[model samples]
Target: MFQPRQMTKLLIAASKDHIEEVIGELYKRRLFHIEDYVRNEQEEWSGYSIGTSLTQADQISSELVKIRSIINNLEINEEQLPKADYTKQSELSKKIASDLPDIAARIEAILLKRSGLEAEQKDLEQKIETLNPFLAFQHPLEILSGYETISFLAGYGKGTPVLPSESELFTSPVRRGEAFNIVAVRSGQLAECERILLDAQFQKVVIPQEKGLASAAVERYQQQITGLQSEIKAIDQEFETIKKQQQLFFVSSEELLTAEIEQAAAPLRFATTEHAFVIEGFVPTNEAVSLVTSLQKATGDKIEIQELEILDLNEEPPVEFQNSRYAQPTEALIDLYVRPKYTEIDPSLFMAILYPLMFGFILGDVAYGTILLVVSLAARGFVKGSEMGTKLIQILRNCSVSAILFGIAYSEFLGTSLPWHPIWLSRHINMGGSASHGVEYVSHVPELLILSIWVGLFHITLARILGAKNASVMEHGEHRSKLMFAHIGWILVMWGIIIAIWSYFPLLLMPDLTGLPLIAGISSSALFGGILILIGIVFIARDNVLELMELPTIISNVLSYTRLVAVGLSSVAIALVTNYIAITMIIDPALKNFTAISIILLIAGIIVFLLGHTLNTALGLLGGGLHPLRLHYVEFFTKFYRGGGKIYNPFGMIRKYTEAEK
Candidate 1:
């Protein structure tokens, strides 16, 4: 798995010799063939069309058995089955396809009718289920299917009065409409007419408003009426069920049936006469060789297979992109992140080494690192939001080792004295002072930053080298020499320029105008760098004299690494702030006397500890790593890197869902 490898080649051939035997065997095995007439990626297989024979006839036949079970459950007979002829099936499919809207309308009408019946039936059942046998009644309320309008006397009222809707929206005194007649009916007269309402889109209808009660008593009356209103709704539901059964007779089950051999030959019916056999599919790399060989032997030399080699297909112009080598992490790290663009090199390798080192150097607290390591380990398995959480935890876990190492170097152990203190610090401290003087401070953090810059330079250089390699391979004709010279010349210029600037420019910022003259001694180095840059620009721009101006522009772009030092200093400054706050709390006796002060100190200390580390860790990840990646992608890759090459995807069995890759 560690070894890098190139993609394999595909072999293709064409033959027309054993067409009949091939078709027969394919039918017997229930294996289908796919044809894409257009030699491009967007073409779809026409096997889904009606009248096209399914090559997986056996598979479809198996599916038919399931359909038969459903039909049997519904008690549909053979005579009820539509004709299963291949021609008839095709014709029926075409007819269904042609007038789908009309069919939908009919289906909807039937469903509406069924829904009314269902609602009515459900209302009746609920009323029955809610019956209380012990309730007294003057006379039994009889349930009937037909309507009756009868009123002898109003119940529980000394007098009765009626009010009509006379508002502007419904009825205005100025513009009166016809008065509607009304009667109270206890019997179910409307149930028969509701069948017509099924085709109607009346899911909800408003009851006409009547008024004769005081506003304060209306709520009480409504609670009583709501209970009765619920009963009628149940009755509507039952009526709908009966209407649904009648609709099913119109839809044929034949298309849903399994016809094994016929389904397998489905695709063959769509193939053109010019193409004897067509096969389009994916196979896993491991199984590809064996499957291709077996198929060749079975079909004999009369059949031919053609494969498309996508990755090596030289059909497009090349563009530059980041090389994968610099970012590659160990195999142990791959399970944590999304797949990188290039599989040859994992990007995590540089991150895996540098991240922990930076964290440990800045934090340098044994207790903090240990706690982070433990928490990261625990959370890695349980964090569930984004996958990035898992990766972040893994990164923290890796960095914990660096923290331990740096903690040892700094001689810090849970804010206590180390097992050994530096000899130089021993001379400068009184016996009662805190352990800051205990460990010889590595005091070499500035040197470490320098080392980091060197590492960045190396990675960037390597990226340029790969870019040249890409250019050499892609532009192999006469232009190859020019490309090679440009890449080499640019690298030399960048190296010299960086060295000169690093050694001399920092002195310019020093509080000494006298030392600024020392920069002239390195003047020759700058001159060399500028000349090389100019030459590279001229060559890359195809000997155009105007392109020499691009040298200064590109050089400025390459020198954005000053942000590295700026960010590293920020990390150190954050740590100092935390230390100052923590020490100030412990040393001030007046503040220590108050409980609130101690509480504030505790809260602030914890906050700074957690917040500072998180911020530094993020800065380290982005500024330390991503900026270097940007250098590789922009500066180095600009020399030459082709990005449009198609990925090598082999043909294999594809899992639809839930199954893991083989």
Candidate 2:
């Protein structure tokens, strides 16, 4: 669809007595995009003010925080968790009151114990590392430091320092080539020991205070570390068991609490007086009547839902994409860039059409497309419950189909030509003679490059037309008319350049266009094209004289699409090289020889084949996806799209794990 869903403003006014019933009905329908009633944004009166949260808002929020902490501590992954059956709000609330506290306390206790053990294990390991240099020393650790009467330096030094006979010293080359020494003396001889060690360039290193033989201390720490590790491992296993048993409960409770808190806080967005409340929001035009009827039925006509005049909006209505199912997944792509303005065209439809088409055009290999198709299907389960991930997988599935269709036309299979000649174009029509490592080059690539340029021209022209329409709808009078003409000027400049090129260099990039009417005394299309360009400049000048500086941009934007062909050709070339090296150089030769060394070479070739194509496949997917996205965001959307519109998020949650009662 060209436009977002049509929306209408509504005023929901009701007695405070029916607030609960009215909010419930609204949530059930999930149609409204509520506007917050803040003093800064709305007219303030003596009695009218923002409503407070409903009863138990704090209690529900506190319970929800506990559930989230437990989930985080257990490392519960949403995708890996199984769904629970339909759970009523009453039932979930009861479970939260009865079961949540004990489970939270148990998990908290077990995790704290595990954390303590891990911390102890780390400390022991550090102590062992510090004592490693002294392991070979024929001395007890109790003699190392910790003495008030003794002064000592323990660290790396140049060599053993000469000290007073009353002082004691031990030195060893422990850290690479550096000497590690421990010098100790009675307090009376401390000054002499310090001077000698300082001359030796001693750099002190800290050591843990402990008692016993150095070897015995290290052995004791290692034992403690081993015991702590075992305890921690057991704790981890218990956690995994608890996660398995309680995942369904926690996941379901999280959703219910989250939704409950949302409803409890709904009043914060409403304006309330002494006994009445008013809620202002937008709903799809088609749903406005349904919403009113549904609320009346549920509240027994106690709640009032009126359709207000949709005029003089302080802010634009939230954009809800209205597109066919085939184009729906592309909405995620648009969201990554920016949501379209309600007044502008939704580019999802065009993106759904072109994004895959361009990707498929660039990666036209049947084997690679098939591989990608299988990958997307296999990965669907891994990324379950991720909406963006699912949408991306869906988009990839469509792109895979497109790639297969193009691959059929190109008659390519894993960088080699199929048995039959190309139905449309041969990416590998002429393989180059003997390349390095038995690799071959795809030389007949000019036609695809030329086709990419043509695609660019069409894509840019479409953008200009849409840009002009958007400018017309969003601007007024002189400004509107000027913008429309400027868009047309861009279109003309591109075509004029092509036509002029055709006159000067016939059949250079495109087909011959020699059958054009003559201009003035000359029979050259250049004269006619130059005239169009001059007139286009004048039309563009009416909008802004400075826009003429961007005239060359039309050429650059069109030229950018050439990546569609260039990236594909590079992929094709890699595939050919991979096949040639694996099959021709190693696989084929080894099969004939049939020896042990040949068998080893055969395995090596298989590795090369798999790894080379694996790398190429990743590169192809990246380039294929990013280049088209860039072209759309940078070249295509800049023409017509004025995004940054707020997304339509209704005041309700989509229950993924729970459902209605049967």
Report per-prediction Cα RMSD to one decimal: 14.3, 4.2
TM-score of 1: 0.51
At residue 510, what lDDT does model 1 achieve? 22
- Give lDDT tens digits, candidate 2, residues 332-390: 99999988888888989999999999999999888888989999999999877788999
- The lDDT of each candidate is 0.43, 0.84
Count of clashes, each model:
57, 0
- TM per prediction: 0.51, 0.85
Off by over 4 Å in 1: 1-5, 11-275, 278-288, 297-302, 306-376, 382-452, 498-547, 553-558, 586-641, 648-662
Best by lDDT: 2
lDDT digits (tens) for residues 1-662 of candidate 1: 21122332333333334443444343333222232333333345443322345344554454445344434433455434434323344444354345443544554464466566556556544443333210122222331112344221111111121322221111111114322112233224334323322333222222212232223233444454465456435433432342244223223423323222443454443333344445443333444466556566667755566555545224321111232433332222333222333322323454455555655654454655676678778886676434556556666676666666665665555433368652221111122243342333344445444544555566567656765655566565777777666666557666656645644455322222223334356455455556665655555566344645565644555444444445544544544444444554343442557676676766666676567666655554455345434554455444444443333232222211111111
